[model samples]
Target: MKLLLLKTLLQRRARDEGFTLPMVIALGFVMILLGMTNIVKSSEENLNAITQNSSSDALAVAEVGITKYRELLNQNRILTIYNDDQWNTNANVTGQACNDLTTTPTGWEDGGTATAPNDTTKWWELREDTDGDGTDELIGEYRLVSYQYDIDDDDFDSSTPPTNNNGQFSPSDDNANTTDDFTFNDVTYDPLGVIGTSNSPEGYNPTGILTVQGRSTDGSEAQIKVEIPLRINQNDLENLDPALWIGSTDTTYLANLNGNLGSLTVTDGNVVIIDAASAGSSGCSDPADGASYTVISDAREVPSISSIASKRTEAVNAGINNSIPVTSPAVLGKTDDDPYVTPPSGATFDEDIHCANISDCRYYYDLSATDITAVTETDGIAKVTLYVDGNLNINQDLGSNVSSSYLEIYVTNSGSITIDSDSTNTINALIHAPESQLTVNGTGTVKINGSVWVDKFVNNATVEIEPDTTRISSLNTAPSYKLYSTATARTPRPLTGSPTNWVREEVQ
Candidate 1:
């Protein structure tokens, strides 16, 4: 009975107990732990990849930006040098070398041994064994160095090759020795280099070379150097041709009057001499109006008798003694009588009419020997007559070709008349003022049928005459009245207390 009870209790205990629950709990814990480990490993791998790519990309972009900035700086320097007026090709300022970074390794230091690391600060000590020797001998060294930023730490690091086995680079050292170790302050950090040698207060590091390295955002490395030459300004080309600069031609003309004509004289019977001497006066005047004349200097004296006599004797001996008859029958009329009363019925003469004023007189009639005749003087008319008995002589001293039919006449008549031409050729005539004096002043042609007389010549006046193929003469003489008259006789005064009249009044 005791044995049976024990067996039953044991059976009950065995049936109530469970071992699968604990086992299932332990298996769940293990799976959770394995999953957590896989998640941590994947996260770390992804973060590492992202960090490396981000660092490389940032570095590339920064390098590209720096390169562009440097290029712009170089271009600006070149322009500044070119615009300087004092720039000269032979001028000695300062010079440095421009190197291609792609071909040369900048900021390089030589390692003491092949297995040992190099000191970047000792760039000058670096030497290439061009002859394949086991050891390199120091020769010439590159002056420029380069560096890149460590994107992971935001620190600047030299991209140039190591200079020596010291595995260091410093910009503070003046010589490339083992004592020189690269430091942040030793490298030339300026990206622009615009400050030039004054980049440091104690002066730029000689042995402590700077390293400038650039990379494009697309992963391209570029290294270049530029040369800037000074040039002269546009205005500084002293020997340049004026035509090329101004793009035009230059010209000039005569300025003012130089001098005056000399003296004149006349001596003969009924002969008129015209003075061709230059007159220094300023304005024109009338010949018939006794009050209108040019002012003459009291210092102006007539020619001496000896001079006149010599000229007259020379002229007479030249077979020029042909004279007009003084006793020829005069026109049967008074000074105011009409001389054209017997004009032919079907004749015509060139005529011009001007305003009725003494200041403006019209000239008419053909300038030919056949049209040479006298007419009457009326209120607005003045007549001119030339009487030829046998022959007339026309002398032109200026030595110019004379037209046989040329004639000049001045008449005050407002109406036309018939001009009787003895020749069939056309007559060339020039007629001017009836009251103003006409002076033959230039070298020209002239013809005459009889004698001519000219009393005086005003300043700046010219006269040309052509007469018939006959004897003509001329005589020059002084005026009979004063040339310049005072205004005292012609000016009138205002009555007392009346406003004074500033205008001058004409005398009756």
Candidate 2:
């Protein structure tokens, strides 16, 4: 009887054992499913992180676009080849312009024209990684490029502006002194709405505003804007007093060493001499004075000849780097072969531009080899830059209708610039021939309006040069004529709108 009870108890124990094994198996299955669920969740998180990283990279690419433009508009790149012209109205870049310019003129005055004024908004792309290390990627490109012009800035927006450049943003006054520095018109823009009108506490320029948009291969993109005021006007250059910033390794004649052979009149500017002594033996006597003139003095405490040349070259390089690439020959002139002489009567700059619009524009001029040197301007228009690799014969009349700040003639690798205008009309331009001399001789009443810089000066006592501050500065517009860059100036735009200002959907 005891053995029978034992067997019955064993049977019960076996049934309980079977149920336990099944429970264990079911729990094991649940554990495996839970592990899989966690893995799936982690994978989703990784995917999201990857997406965010891509977006960030796209944003960086866009920022790079804006930065590229900023480098082009740097002020240091736009100084006249002479003077400490390094002499800037902006105190930050100036060591000296006048007696303590940092203290005088109070602050930066753009003279109504931007102190660092730029012309237009330029565009470009990021394709090759020139850095052999494979850092440069064939990412994306800028789709849109635009420049804004304040209606108040010389009213440049009027009368069919040169097609597709800049336009006025509003008509409200942007008085720099007033507390309400920004006034936005109740204008509606894209779905994004009128954005960041008062974004910058330091008001926007009444001259230039640059805009550029960049995209990446990943289909992500970004846009940026910046202020790029052009420093085109030279009238404010007075602070550099002796607007004539000259330097020489040898004597730069100011007055005939032997006698006051001819006459020169600097209505309201100072004369700065560098090197040996003043160009002429006798300091230029201001006719306005009682048969007396300002004494010739080396404005610089120590001659800054080499330093000036080096800096000027750097500035030129900067301008060239920042410019839009356009192919133009050094020699520009009247006939196809007469690039060294005056144009035929009916020839106009328009004609040259039309011809240059085609392929065979540059016949055989070589700037790298210094192949030619001579500028004999043709009559119809008053402005043109004849970059010769040899000598300059500037004997043309600058038409009466010459525009302010117009014409620039640069004679590179030259020994001298001889002048004998057929007509006495004033010829305006900024002539730079660092290694040459200037010799003026004309029977008719001759007048030259602008600055001449070279190794020396030799006047036949016939031509009188009157400083016309209005001549267009080649240094200021270096990119347009000498560089592969465009004529526009660009910088990172003002940051006006924050997340609070952007559309709710647009902000991350």
Candidate 3:
């Protein structure tokens, strides 16, 4: 009986052993599968991290390109060979190359050819020290391509290919269509809305679209495009603040014992007097009326004579010396009879004069003689910046009308100015003579519709000297022609506002 029981037990134990062996093998296979799945997940995570890093690097390189372009504009180096009129030719790139920056622009190519001159090499390579060692590692590269953003169509893909082989990307680009192409087509834009009237779009040049293609070492690429518009610098005329500025600190009576005869109405500015502030300090009938100006003792110090003279010197250097010998009844600027007057000597008064209109405008005038009977801009509107070495005498009105003409008389050398116009007539001018005196001597009411900056002002006649808002606004219209070069005139608009004026976008 014992032998039979032992045999049965041995068979059962063998069966149990077979089942356990199969279970062990199955557990080993399941463990191997889980290890393989973990390995695959780790590989995918590493690949995703690498892709994300490349994308980030490409975007950083593209932003660097935009920064480089902005730096060029800030340096005022954009219009060295171009103007606002031919803004299309001033594009950073031409044709489809603007969108497809892999094919470089005309002026910026690899090993630049005759048709493409790479003055500033092609790629901006990015280098980094990945391992924190002394040597820098090459990370990525980027290139810049720009297009002219015309406000008329409001699109970015309208650039045409360059036509000429000059490789300068200039007037010969679009069949030599070098006319004033910056004017908008039926678009209404009110800048600042100060005048209430829709101003002419002469100074508001068209915008530019700058695209940057950034590539990482791992073949990852990205594109970024931004709008670069032209903007007027706010502090372009920082010196000309007060409407009527007196530089004299000497005790001079503004009123000649007659309680100050005429009126001096100021608008949109102050009447700063460096002299002692007393009752009737401004010498006006109503100093606090429609004119809200102050008469502080130390409001502002007078500008030096040399500083004012340097401005005249700068204008002379800029080929603005449209000079003539002052004679009685001699017209200085353009007239209806001779609208396009090319002077016999000195600089030529052509369409490039610094003014609102682009016709034959004469901005700088170096009058040889001192006396003058009449000065007028008979042809349309003109702005004159007259430099008088000797004493100036105005026997008649300086400008024709307030709206049509403007004048800035500079008498840097110690000289005086005598305004002897009729009471009914008006003298519209900005007189700046820090080392001289101004005498308004007329029996009738002579109105001066501009500002005055002199050492001393002697009002012997009935005169009203104040600056109107219209004239003040004209000083800011075209700042390239301003008397003070306080700041650069035109610059790329700041990255503000909506996508229309200035914006940034990522390209697919």
Per TM-score, the best of the predicted structures is 3
Residues 43-97, candidate 2, lDDT per residue (tens digit)? 9999989877776666666566555544432322221111122233333223222
Please, what are the lDDT tens digits per residue for candidate 1 over residues 469-502?
A: 3221111111101000000011110001111111
Please identify which of the two predictions, 1 or 2, would achieve the higher TM-score against the true structure.
Answer: 2
TM-score of each: 0.17, 0.32, 0.38
The CA-based lDDT of model 1 is what? 0.24
Q: Which stretches of candidate 3 lie over 4 Å from their true place?
A: 1-18, 76-121, 127-139, 157-205, 217-219, 232-508
Give the range of the ten consecutive residues with the poorest summed lDDT in model 1: 244-253
The superposed Cα distance between candidate 3 and the true structure at residue 87, in angstroms, equals 10
Tens digits of lDDT, candidate 3, 393-449: 776555635432246677867777777755566667667788888787767777666
What would the TM-score be for candidate 1 when compared with the true structure? 0.17
Task: Flag the better candidate by lDDT, 1 or 3.
Answer: 3
**Model 3 residue 482 lDDT?**
28
